[model samples]
Structures are given as structure tokens and as C-alpha cells.
Target: MMKNIQLKAMGKINLGLDVVRRRPDGYHEVRMVMQTVSLYDKVGITVEDQPGIRITANLSFLPLNENNIVYKAAKLLMDEFSIDQGVSISLEKHIPVAGGMAGGSTDGAAVLYGMNRLFSLGMGQKRLMELGLKLGADVPYCIMRGTALAEGIGEVLTPMPPMPDCWILIARPPFGVSTRFVYENLHLEKIDRHPDIDGIVRAIEDSDLEAMCARLENVLETVTIRKHPQIEEIKNFMRERGAVNALMSGSGPTVFGIFENERECRSAAEAVRERGMARQVYAVKPFNP
Candidate 1:
């Protein structure tokens, strides 16, 4: 029987994000605290007798050929090892596309990790991460698979200690935000207040939920919220509905409400859904690697 493997590619949420400066490469220098969440896309990989890659997803809008990140990951591996075997990848996308959740990057990371195991490629995590960096800035963190403090275009990661047990309510509006455009439009001079990165890191170490909530800040929030008032409305709704900390994740149209417990998280999610303020709402725990 051909080797088959299935992997879960979890989505990411930026607890705090700051754009430091613009680089010569035109990519913004950033400092972000990113956490993986239980919400994920399921990727099923199966070796094929045929000699080319095949990718299928329930979402017809996604690209299935070489342009797909999954396909690119597989192709990168094949080229590196000169392997003859082909693979088929099927993605069940649960994460919102282009919602600043890093769905595509997560899928790419899953492909690299799954293929490494399924094909016995013997590629170390370091190598895989290196390859992942070429695919996307967020891919490295996905491969790392845990809470992390990311810097320098989001490739530099320092693994954060596990967070306190909590539930998360994530809501995304019907539209998607373009990360590239958000960065392009960002006005650096107007960004007078900076997130207290050191303070937030310390709070995580201490497991001080209140301190973390107080420190929760995203510079991109200004840009995103200004363009899409719905994001701000969702954030306000979540806060009123009992979220301890509510913020927009990534360059998002998706806003997350962090709760101290599952009951509050579920209640808030239900309330938000009933209010019809969001297209989708997910109740999930923070992913721990």
C-alpha cells in the first residue's frame, strides 16, 4: 500500500503586532507575538503511482496546481532530493482565506512536515523551516508549531512558554483583508504608541492574564480598523459580550475574543453569532505546538 498521512494545519492569531520599519526589500520589519489555535485545516497526503503532483480541496476557489503553497512545498522537497514519487494533497480548509490567519502558510508548513514523515525524507526541522521561509514569512512559525514571539519579517521566532488554559472566540466578517495592501498603506509616523513587547513577554512567563490583556496591542489594528469599521464593531461587541481581551488578529477582518474559560468563550461566540455581526465564529483553544 502507498504511504498516506494526514496532518492538521492550525491557524495563527497575533496577540500583539508592531510594525517597526520598512526594509529595503519592501517587507515591513515587525515584532509580533503569534499563537497557534485549535482551528485548523485538515490536509490528507497520499503517494501516487503517477509522476506528478495532484492537489484537491473542497474550496474550489483555492489554486490546486503549482501555485498552491502545498504544491510548492512538495515541489521544493522533490527538487531537493530528486525524488521520483508523486503525491496527492487534499485540503479541508476551515480557516478563513486571506483573513490574516495564515491559512495558506499553515497548509504549506503541514505539507513540508507531512511529506518529510511520509516520504522519510530525513529533513530536519531546521531545514524544513529554512525551506518554509522561502514559501512565506508565517510558514516558519507554523512549522515551529507553538506560541512564539516573531520578529524581522516574522521569520525570527522565540518559542513562548505555554499559555494559561483559556478559550478563544474568533469571528471573521465576509470579506478578506490584503496583508500587502495593509502594510503598504500603513503610516509609520502616525504610529506614536508602541506595544510593550518586553512587558507582554514577562506577563506570559508569569501567566498573568490581566497583564497580557492590558498589553494586547496591534499597530496594524489602526490601519485595518480604519478601513473596515466592521472589525472595530466586532471587537467592541466581543468586549461587551465578556471577552477579557479582544483584538484583530494579523492584518485582519477577523477579530478574536479571549476568555478566561470555555463557558465564557462559548457563550460569547453564540452571542456574536446570534447578533449576526460576523459571517463565522469559532470557539477554540490555543494550540500548543
Candidate 2:
């Protein structure tokens, strides 16, 4: 009998992000708080008698070959665990591609998690998170889920107390922003104001929605917004539509708003779409796990 496992690869939003400095390794030191949202990609895994992996996805834009992180994760697990059984992986994506939501990294983490469970690998969470780092900086946090304060180029994660449960409305413009482009152009020296990392952490731990709304910030937005001023327009639009607070997430073209009610969030989603400000708008909640 084939062992089958189903999992949800949740997307994330950066409530606060600050680039600390450029690193010798070509990576930047970062201090940020990341929160998983209800938005997700469905991942299905099935193990078979053969000894090779097969990957598939519903999205035509996604590659199913070795280039895909999901396939890369499966290869890593199989090589590390010496698993001989074949696995079939299927992905149905709800998260936007390259929208600065860690969509691909989350999918990669899901495969590592699901394969471990399906094959009875009995790997500890610590080991899985360690392995995830080899894939991408965000993969570690994706594996951890929930809310976290990430430092050290986004690999060091400190799990946070749950943020007060509320609606998160995300809007992605029709164009995609390249993270590398944003990073390369970012001039930390020129940045006048940085996000209050400690304040956001305190707000999450205290579950103070007002303080959180007041504290939402992303330093990378200084560079990204310069390249695409529409990002700022999206933030303003979301705020005007009833969001208590709105900010760009990660190295974005994708910005999100904090809403107090579902109806208001849905209304903003409709307005962003109808106004042609965003190609996609999702009303989501914080995912606690």
C-alpha cells in the first residue's frame, strides 16, 4: 500500500523587515518578523515501489523539473535519509508566484515535512529546520510556521506568541518584483528611518492590535517602492478602503493590509481588484502553526 500524505504550504507576510548590513557572503544581515497567513498551497505526496521522484503542479508557470524547489527538497531528503521508495508530489498553488510571500520556499519546506512523515523518517523538527536552511533562508521559518522573529539573513527564528487573531488582506500588483534586484539596489546608508523591530515584537507578545498597526514597517520598501511607486499607491488604496494599517511585505510588489473585520477585508480586496491596482487580493488570517 502506498503511503499518502496531504499538507498545506502556508504563505507568510513580513510585518516588519530591516536590512542590517551587507554580508561578505553576498547575503545581507536582516532583522524581521514574519507571520504565516491562511493563504496556502495544497501539496499531496504518495510513495510508491519505484526509486525515483516525480513532481507535478497545476500552475503552468511552475516548473516540475529539478529547477523546482519542491523537487530539490525531495532529492535532498531521499539522499540524506537513503530512502529507496519513489514519491509522487502534486502541488495546487494558491499563493502567488514570486510575489515575495515565500511561496516556493514554503512548498519546498512542505515536501521535506510531508516526506518525513510519510516515510516514517522520524526526523526531529530541529533536524528538519537545519536541513531547510540549505534550501533557502525563508525555508527555515516556513518549516517553523506561526509567527517568528527572524535575524541573521532570515535563518535564525525565534517563535513568537500568537498575534491577536485578525484579518490580513494581501494585494499583489500585476508585475513581479525580483528580490535580488531590490537587494542590489537597496542603500541602507541612504535609508533615514528603519522599522521598530522591538516594538513590533512587543505588540505581538502583548497582542496589542493598535500598537501593531502603528508599528508595521519594512525598510526594503524604500528601495522597492522607488522602483515601482505603484506599491505605495497600493498601500494607500488599501488603507483608504478601511485597513487600519497597510505595508509592503518583504522585498515587495505585494503589499498587505490589516483589517479588523472580514467584511471590510473583502471589500478592500474587491476595490483593489476593481480599481486595477492589484491583479490578486486575498483576505486572510494569521495561521497559528
Candidate 3:
């Protein structure tokens, strides 16, 4: 019999992101405040007598072979745990691909988490996170979902107080932003201002929404916004419509606004949609896991 397990692969937003410096190893050090959102993708995994792993997803463009992170996660667990059972993975994706929201990383994290439960592997969050880092820098944080502080190429994490109760309006424009382009063009010495990562952490601990929103910043905006001015326009639109504050998330074309009122959040979503500012928009709450 094939045993199946299902998991929710939640998306995350960066409350504040700062590029500390680039290392000789070619990886940049960063300090970021990460918050998980209610938005997620459904991931289903089945273990059976088959000899190899097979993957399927709702999106035709999503790769199902070993090139997929989900496949790599499964392979990692099977080889490490010496599990002989073959696996089949299915994804009903809702999170946008390459949206700088850690969409793919969360999906890979779900596979690691689901396999541990389905096979009764007894791997704790620590062990799972260790395995996840092998896949991607964001995978470790995705495994330990919630509000957190991420540093050291995004692998080091410190759980923080849950974000204050509020509605989040997420909007992603019709086009995609190239993360590589954003990073390659970033000159650390030229940046005038950096996000206050510690200050944002303190605001989160104090449960001060206004203070946190005011501090919300991402240094990459210098490069990304220059190439795509639409991002700044969206942020201005969200704020004018009733958002307490708004900022671009990750290396974005995706901008999110913090709204204290649910009605205001919904109205913002509708306006963004009506104006065709974004191809995808959603109103959701902060998710703590």
C-alpha cells in the first residue's frame, strides 16, 4: 500500500533586509527579519513500492525532475535515512514562482518535514534544518516557520515574538524581477541607508505595529527599483489607499502593505486588481508556526 502525507508550504516576507558585506566565498552576508504569511501551497507526498522518485505539479512550467528542489529534498532524506521506498510528489501551488518570497524553498522544506513524519524518522527541527541548509539558504528558516531573525547567508535563525495582529495585502506585478540582476548590480559601499534589523526585532517584541512598519526596509530596493519603477508606484498606491505602510518584499516586484483593518486590506487588494497594478493579489494574516 502507498502511504501518503500532505503538508502546507507557506510563503514568507522579509520585514527588513540588510546586506552586511560580501564574502570571498561569493556569498553575501545578510541580516533580515522574516515573517511567515498564511499564503501557502499544498504539497502531497506518497511513498510506495516504486523504484524511484516521480513528481507532478499543477503548473506546466514547474519542473518535475531532479532539477526540482522537491525532488532533491526527497533524495536527501531517502539516502540519509536509508529508506528504500520510492516516492511520488504532487504540488498544487498557489505561491508565485521566483517571486522572492521563498516559495520554492518552503516547498522543499515541506518535503523534508513531511517525510520525517510519514516515515517516523524522529528527526527533530534541528536535524531537519541542518538537512535543509544543504538545499538552500532559506530552507532552514522555511523549516522553522514564524517571525524570525536570519543572518549568515540566511541559515542562522532566531525566533522572535509573533507580529502584531493585522491584515497583510500582498501584490505581485505581472512581470518577474531577476534576483541575480538585483544582486549583481548592488554595490554595498554605495548604499546610503540600511534596514534596521535589530530595531525591527525590538519593535516585534514590543508588539508595535506602527514602529515596525516605519522601520520596514530592504537595501536591495536601491537596485531593483531603479530597474523597475513600478515597485515604488505600487508602494505609493497601497499607502495612499489606507495601508499603514508599504515596502517591497525580498528582491521584489512583489510589494506588501500592512493594514490594521481587514476592510482596508480588502479594499486595497480590490483597487490594486482593478488598476491592474499586479497580476496577483491577496489579503492574508500573519502566520505563526
Off by over 4 Å in 3: none
Look at candidate 2 and give me any clashing residue pairs: none
lDDT of 3 by residue, 101-164 (tens): 9999999999999999888999999999999999999999999999999999999999998999
RMSD of 2: 1.1
Error of 1 at 177 (Å): 0.8
Q: In order, what lDDT does every prediction score?
A: 0.90, 0.92, 0.93
The C-alpha stretches of model 1 lying farther than 4 A from their native spots are none
Q: How do the predictions measure up, each by TM-score? A: 0.98, 0.98, 0.98
Query: What C-alpha lDDT does candidate 1 achieve relative to the native structure?
Result: 0.90
Question: Which pairs of residues have clashing backbones in candidate 3?
Answer: none
- Candidate 1 lDDT tens digits, 62-139: 998988999999999889888798999999999988888999999999999998998888889899999999999999
Q: Model 1: clashing residue pairs? A: 145-289
Which candidate should be chosen as best, given lDDT against the real structure?
3
